[model samples]
Target: MTAGRPAPAGPVWDRPEPPSRAALSPLSRERIVAAAIALADADGLGAVSLRKVGAALDAGPMRLYGYLSTKDELLDLMADAVHGEIELPLDAGWRETLRALATGIRAAALRHPWFTELAGGRPNIGPHALGVMEAALAALDRSGRFADIDEMMSARGTVTAYVIGAVRSEIAEQQVERASGVSEAEWRTATGPYLKRMLATGRYPTLARFVREGADRSAEEWFTAGLETVLDGLGQ
Candidate 1:
């Protein structure tokens, strides 16, 4: 008999029809996680309920229970999966290492804005998260300035904090865009009367000059400049 192909009396397709969940291979934890992440990416984390996730994966919500005891565990898995996308550093030197690490994490958060919400929930003590931290800390350790573990940990904290702040700023920009329905430039224009009113009061001469001289500057430019200043301070 020909392998896979149906008999002469049957359909020509060799493959069996994909089965319903009742007859299908059981849904695994990995399948649940991938579905949840897809849901998050498509419709934000708020849309990633158990039922919705299961629907996306073609499995019953009850099937997810076998893998995840609660939605929280699923969230944890989702967060770790996002972190996994942040490829670990393969090169040396603390500055290069820190820059690459921070940039990669920032990109990941940008890719999945929901990850930012997960960052504050728990100490990411999972293997994947731990390994990322360890890689970064190890690079910093090679610098030898951090004689004490606390100091090294603090330094690591600063870098991660910086990335968190950057991601939050990104989230805020999206929120502002939705709420204001105006570009930053348009916002400045719209708020000119208020800015002028404050400046005319004579209490904000410095701010007045700044507003006058840099009225055309974009909020994004200001944010980037501020972030660079922060990184410079951390490097120093």
Candidate 2:
């Protein structure tokens, strides 16, 4: 089995047959997940009530209960569904591998901003999530230089947490833009004078410099710099 393969839920040979596209009468997990993803994409994660999902699929809410036990279960499935969208390379160097993993995760989170909110609500150890975890661990193992297993594990957590925190901040910024109709750059432009005036009070020259410099850094530069700093820290 591959390092990231999800645990055998059941015999592969015993897997249930998928419903035909023409078989409108058959309700399956894939259809249910698609409906949930659409509802989430359209209205955000909080809008994904079982009833709403069922309504989107033209089924009664009670009918969904037979397939998904509760809203939590549905969310778990939804989180995994979002994870399944991430693609990993079969071969890469250690830094390239880790960078790819981080980039893929960031892309996935951006594509499904709802998934970040779901992460807080659900205890997601689903297949795709496991695959991500396994892939990161495998990459570190293949690096062949870590002194302690515990240290390696801790470094991995730190790397992932930093990435997730950055992604969450970006998502929040985007959500604010959507709701308030203010571009981030516009917000910065509006606030910059007030912030600079406050900082010029001189108690925090370092912070003032950062704010000024940060204004000049493009979003990509900020993200790349942060990721590189984290990688450098891990090296030490």
Candidate 3:
């Protein structure tokens, strides 16, 4: 009965359209995570911040809040995304399955060094990370070597501990090289005289022998040898 209100304009849906605005690509968690990954890859984990990530994606930091609540969440996404790069083998023997997982993780860590920095401290419960863990546990269970689930989990933890420690060592060596602008060989050569002097004191016979006779293995070879030793221990 309030006829003076002009029928309430027949609903807002009947209103005329406003001028069109420029169309921008919609934001997504994937995009945000990807942007953060790229930043970490380029400049290391310290370089990654929500504002920088948002700038990388051409969005404001506040806009990213809709997709993730905190930078830690974004990092968890990035870590899982890196995990997604690992290839899960099919129908392989237990040893082969574990080898594939370990090597795939190593490869991924080499590509994204920041990943090793976040590897153990934070809980990686994302889907891809969980998939990798699931694959390893299943392989361990199928091997029938473990006495029980407890032993199986222990084996998994041992292998993971080795991998994370080994990869962190590798990445640290790499960072040292990158920072010093000196290759490992170059550094060894530069320090050769000092090392020789120290070794001459006879305080490090084993190490001196190692320095003289150690096999000149690449990083990959070292990683594989260590991994194989761990696998053998698990087998026994």
Best candidate per TM-score, number? Answer: 3
Question: How big is the positional error of residue 136 in model 3, measured in Å on the Cα after superposition?
Answer: 0.5
Backbone clashes in model 1, listed as residue pairs: none
* Ten contiguous residues minimizing lDDT sum, candidate 2: 10-19
Model 2 alpha-carbon miss at residue 175, Å: 1.4
lDDT of each: 0.74, 0.74, 0.84
Each model's RMSD to truth, in Å?
11.1, 6.3, 10.4
- Please identify which of the two predictions, 1 or 2, would achieve the higher TM-score against the true structure: 2
Q: Tell me the RMSD of model 2 versus the true structure.
A: 6.3
Tens digit per residue, CA lDDT, model 2, 1-236? 32563454442223443434553445777788889988888888778888888888888876665465567667777888887777865556556666777778788888888777765453468888778767777777778767777877777777777777888888888888989999988998999889878998998999977876756775556776788898888776
Question: Candidate 3: where is the Cα deviation over 4 Å?
Answer: 1-23
Clashes of each: 0, 0, 0
Candidate 1, TM-score vs. the true structure?
0.80
TM-score per candidate, in order?
0.80, 0.83, 0.88
Per-residue lDDT of 117 in model 1: 86
Cand. 1 Cα-lDDT: 0.74
Two-way lDDT contest, 2 vs 3, winner: 3
